[model samples]
Target: MFRKASRLRLDGSPRRVVLACCCALFVAASVVSAQQPPAQRITTNFKDADITQIAEAVSMATGRTFIIDPRVRAQVTMLSSTPMTPDAFYEAFLSILQVHGFIAVPSGDVIKIVPDANARTMPGTDLPDRPPSAADEIVTQVIAIKNVSAAQLVPVLRPLIPQYGHLAAHPASNVLIISDRAANVNRIARIIRRIDQAGDSDVEVVTLQNASAVEVVRIINSLYQQQQAAEGGGANPLRLAADERSNSVLVSGDPEQRLRIKTLIAHLDTPLESGGDTQVRYLRYADAEKVAALLKEQVTGIAQAAAPGGGQQAAPPQQQIDRNTTIIADPETNALVITAPPKVMKSLMSIVDKLDIRRMQVLIEAIIVEVQADKTAELGVNWAAWSEDDDTRFPAGGFISPVGGSSLVNLAQLAADPEAAAEAGIGIPNGTTLGIGRIAGTGVNFAAMLRALRGDANTNVLATPSAVTMDNQEAELKVAQEVPFITGQFTNTGAGGTLNPFQTIQREEVGTILKVTPQGGSWRT
Candidate 1:
């Protein structure tokens, strides 16, 4: 039983009845106390009452101590249809404080109510097992992060916590100190366990066969620094170390990163050849001369940029050109003739691989046909036509008609108006050049469409020519025979004043010829 004779409050303040039910509960407290189960059941129906009055009543029933700070003042309204056990009632009380931006922190033997922002500074229950706290009850947890450095997780996890929540990392111990609501702390802990795994990260020792371990490490670090600066990133996670004692390099990072390091090491650690050798590198896509010039410029720039040891000046541009490198392009074979040591050759070949990519090409296919439009050549279809004589040719499958004559449809003009053409059961998209069923052309705003109407369509294929051309380039196809014609007035005579039988004549080539400048930019979609 609680001491009701003392009209003093739980915090030494005078109590006031906030509602009629408040006094009734205090009056019937003796009866309700007798009915309290092992887990004290609470039947609460709080109105717009001071939260302090509610806390005082809880202390009277449960015998647990509670200290409400002077700054804590708010009105609460809660109603429970049925009774709640001690644990449930406790959670409910904590929630009321949390709704007012306060937290219930268990300090020493008594629970202290304070602002959530100051909960971390006050004494609280330490839960290491990370059991989720009840309601919004603030708790402290020291979580030990494994596999990864705990400090690394702080920056990633800080944004997830609230402003009043506290989160810190101990680098030496690789542990995280989190002071927030119990549920939130436990949530952050689960996230840490998921990402803290040391997945496929290890150290590999690469023995140097020819190259210096220190020099290899220096090149790798230099490239990494350049990339990092370009991307504006944090410190590199990879650790590269040179072991002079064993002439080996130690790489520590993810397995994929280590594989890349090993590949670079393999290329750099090759035995130097005895002397210079010649090799022909055929250019497949890029021009040999252009590639050779680019190589000369790059190699010379590297030499001139390189500083000599002991603070000596670098070699001049002209002198750097002959630094054990000789490159020439053979126009006949479109190949590069290189003369250099094995190490230099290997480096040059790698550059060639990146530069010699096949450019986009367009395949232009064409068919030249003379579809016999007349009946005699139409492969059987004859069209009626009016003519004065009986020998006149018929174009389609119709006999002569006495009534006027049928005019052929102007296909090119009809195609220009898509709306009108659709009424005729045949129409293409507006601004379309050509379409054969589903096959269509993607114009680069330069191609023109040429279409004509034919009857029965007897097709006599004259020639089919196709050519491959580079982007934005042109190609020509011609199938013709040379014909000789008289050019100069000369009699048929021999060398000795006798007329030559073949008389001076000029030979001219005339037949089917096609030229197309394909602009293949539209295919990218």
Candidate 2:
């Protein structure tokens, strides 16, 4: 029984060994099969076939699924004389499709076949009919550029992108974002890479400390014009933009051009002394019109006098006005904004000081008179009327022209005939006349003309000067007069001197004082 059992066990061991070996061999074969490439050979000929059918045959041979867009309805004819590998077949097929305005795009294991014009329009099976999200089919790339503002590069890069592509640049961030098909995105990347490899130009920002924004802009524009004229037809290499808010200039170009501009700006914007190259003078009490006129006239006169002919054969108008100087008068602020070189600004300030100095003060005395109704006709004469023989019309020795609508006449005639003067609207009831005189140097002669007119009993002067004080460019005058007592009769206790009891005198005083200053060669009170 033992011998029989031994034989059975030995047979079982052999069978088990054979089974283990067979399993090992099967696993090895499976691994080899998995590691091997799939068969991609094909042989085909078609007299005339729809492009869809051709795509289908190629897909079947290569074991790759191909989807034909419903919009593709074109038919094609082809002949493949010999069998070809999957790679070669794909290349040949794509070439043939390209000839017929079609393309094949791969999506993972699947291929999309469509007309070239409809490639972007065709919708994917799983994708909705909306535009492709940038996260999906389109690739987004952010590139950093050095020494160039994004705004400056956008124009140069825009035309390089495909029509369906999108490009945007953030100037502050100095980053460029591009969204497009993978191929186009790659192309743009290569382009940017090439540009970066070519080396970047320098971008500089220069702030103007002593230069006006207007002057800087003018200089830049003039330089650009000259550059354009020299270049004739080509684009200007240098680009300049002025920022008035920051009072700065931005420059971009090649190294040499940028250096040239920088040097030019530096030379033009050299700093002046501690006081600066510009000066703003405020005309406190002067009219801006008169000041500006005086400045122009005086500056022109000085320039002409300095010329060869002693104010004759003047220089051209353009040459007379210095280009480096700028004067802006702001009437709202009553200020003269002057910008120029140091010497020129100094000269302008001196001129302003001279023109704004205060000179002499003149005291004007005007007497207002009211005549009685019965005596008004005797004073019927126009005080402002002047004839060829009337040389002494004004006490100060100037012809007194009628102001407003009042007619000028002889005062002597008015004194002779007061009744006629009232008939001519000279001193009638509410009518008034002015006896005006001026004291040139010193001593206020208040009512001097009125005292002279007092010889006629009909004349009545209403106001008189009480005191006059003359300062450098100003004067103060006070006039005191007697007021007629209406019905009250009282003794004057404050009257220290002798009183005129016959005239029934009561005191009434009226005076006006003003400070006068000379502005732009004219007196302002």
Candidate 3:
């Protein structure tokens, strides 16, 4: 029996041993390949190629050209302009292609840009003429303008028109929606003057004393057509009208068709002048940040309404994406409005809708602590104020007193006497010290404990003296990156006993409460 056991342990069967080794090798290869990043191939000749490959190829072959097909007829319409750089030009061109159903490929020294390769060409079809101007340049300029605000617009305008910033927040509060064809330039100018005189009134009404609805409609129709021509019919006037109606009120009823007149009450940032005349316009601001923040709040509100718990987290938990997109008063001025990319906007909406309720406060506190952590002096409006817009346990613009309570005490009020608040432990403002209870026995899980540690109470809880399980392993303490504050490796000795096997433990700042694990895990608080 001993001799048989020794032979089995040695695995004397060569074929069986070879098969097992081959299986292990196969699994190892699969695991390694699975861990590798997805590959992309980019081809200059073909309409469809991998993006990653193209980026890589471009980087590799700086100035080279390779012809994909010589048989295809080259009745070319060359529209070219030298921009800041080849890369910038390519980016701008790519943006245009994304909007349009077309793609461009750079082959060696030459680029083989094409429409859908699968499309069948129609006989006697008149191809539309490409716009004369550099589309990329126009788009870049428009995006830059869209990203700024009226007040921020000062510096940019100051160089052109002095004393721009000093002109007050709202020089003209009224809005004017004009038609592109209507020769009512002077009329709109007068309305602007009146609005400018209103001087920061809550409701700076712009009175359109002249220009009938028909004329405005005609101008809008023309503007719509021009936009359609530029964008290949992606711009819809009806959609714009719908958005306007959704945001504000409808003004007119069509004489023949019974359609309502569109009211453009929203402020405009840039002065829209086409054909050397003032066209359809709105009273807008460059502050896209303010608008973006408001939109995010609205999104959050909508999410909270859908949530049964009356909090950010959805009932069925969903993944949260960091949506950095915002429509703020343009940083440069309140004269123009810009928006983050559509994806950014969509992500922001997703956050408002799908924020984890359990992690809602966690997310908020994390942002607050993270922002203030750097002690950066250039902190803008309190982000908490924006988040407060949602009907949460916390009051809007006030100190959140244990979740749900009215009477908002702004940060200014809290900072008035931080020491007293810290000492009393009740209604202590942000940055005030508060005591945290370190309870023993099986009361709260490690997750709950960590949450409390990072809570407003600001207490550190040590779990070395207590029992903790790591994946059904009877361990005194389990530490991993998933558990915040633990900044080291997790080693299991399989001893199953209370072992003091701490390799290294690093301390954090005074406010930090680092958690040191028995298996070489320590939190840098």
Candidate 4:
């Protein structure tokens, strides 16, 4: 019974120890719960509130610390219809700050808010002051200026640039480098485009062939100076230069000014004419001279014929004739240069047509002659029996045997053999042996005939005859001859050769014995 009681006591003691340990754990958990802050629920709606106000509201709602940088000046609005947890509240607050160009940074339990533009930090500091936004933001752009010098253009464009904008000109390259705000840079580019387009339209180069370069330059300068003087020194932007390489005048100015100058140049380049019309009539070489002479004679005759009535009428004082027509004969070009009134020129041309109607007939005569050399001389010599060193049988050194012939020997047989001919002096030229071996009749060997008639004096070969050999020997020749002749006149004339004696006698008697003739009279009774 005592042993069972001791065992029950031990069990009771373990239950008490278990109860004590549970009580200690409950106390420790209660202490930890008391030390931790409770999760806060936030609910807020702020409309277009300043960043400072938004930050203060967020801090009050979340029961968290927030340090707002003095430079965080951006405004923001926050709206939340439903209740927000602590995390949601922080997220919404930070998003508001960020939307208003502020950056929210957490440090331990506190959040630091700084302007986004001023978010830069020094090595040891958390935030630095932000520079002005407008002055700090810079953009660069390059613009091309055409036909206008950048030095001249920069001054005009500099005034258009904003105060904070900067412009630089690269004159050698004709480009402008501009640095300014995005809006200001765009404005400058527009101005540059307009200026460049205007300059392109104003600039022009005109090629001049017959006009004098110096004279053109002088005229352009004079016009520009006059414009300057008239406008009281506010002259058109004009640059005039004469390009000697291309022989052109480059005029760069306002379009109106260039037009005026071009008009003046046109007027200067036009040839001045007198009150009469000048006409050029082309005539034959001889006809040009004849027309000129005929015009002079006809004009003189008309002037003389319009004088007093008759010789017996005691012709009044000879009235001077107005020979207003001038005719010049240009032999070089075979043209008649006429300057007169329109009607007078027309009348003169009509007369010239009548006087220049003579026809020039050309007679062509031709004769073909075939000259043949007496090749029968070659028949007398037996070339097979002829040999060198046989002076009695064949002439010495005349007919050389093939074995004894030198390499420079030009034998007749070499003409047939090209290799042998090349071994001899020089190879025969093409067509040199055209009429060899083939013989028909005594007609000429054209090649030999040509050689024979080379230096003839009277028979001038104006053009080489179209000579062709029919059967290697018979050659036909075709030649052309020109005979120039003019119509209406022949130098030689003759009387009739056939005559009757009775008629001749009767004619002489009738001439001598006339009935009632003016000089003499004869009576036949």
Model 3 global lDDT (CA atoms, 0 to 1): 0.30
TM-score of each: 0.42, 0.37, 0.13, 0.22
Q: Give the TM-score (vs. native) of candidate 4.
A: 0.22
Stretches > 4 Å off in candidate 2:
1-49, 58-67, 70-96, 105-112, 121-188, 197-213, 218-252, 255-301, 304-332, 337-525
lDDT of 2 by residue, 359-474 (tens): 44455555556676543221322222222233333233223443333333344346658888768667412345555533233433322122111122366786654333233444
Off by over 4 Å in 3: 1-220, 223-255, 259-302, 308-325, 335-525
Span of ten consecutive residues with least summed lDDT in model 1: 399-408
Candidate 4 per-residue lDDT, tens place, 44-152, comes to 6554345564555445545667666666664354556675665565666656654556655455565566565443331111222322232222345667676555656
RMSD each, Å: 30.2, 28.5, 47.3, 32.7
Error of 1 at 407 (Å): 99
Candidate 3, residues 109-154: lDDT per residue as tens digits?
4544344231122111112132213221111011111111233333
**Best-to-worst ranking by TM-score:** 1, 2, 4, 3
Candidate 4 residue pairs that clash: none
* TM accuracy, model 3: 0.13
Q: Find the candidate with the highest TM-score and give its number.
A: 1
lDDT of model 4 at position 88:
68
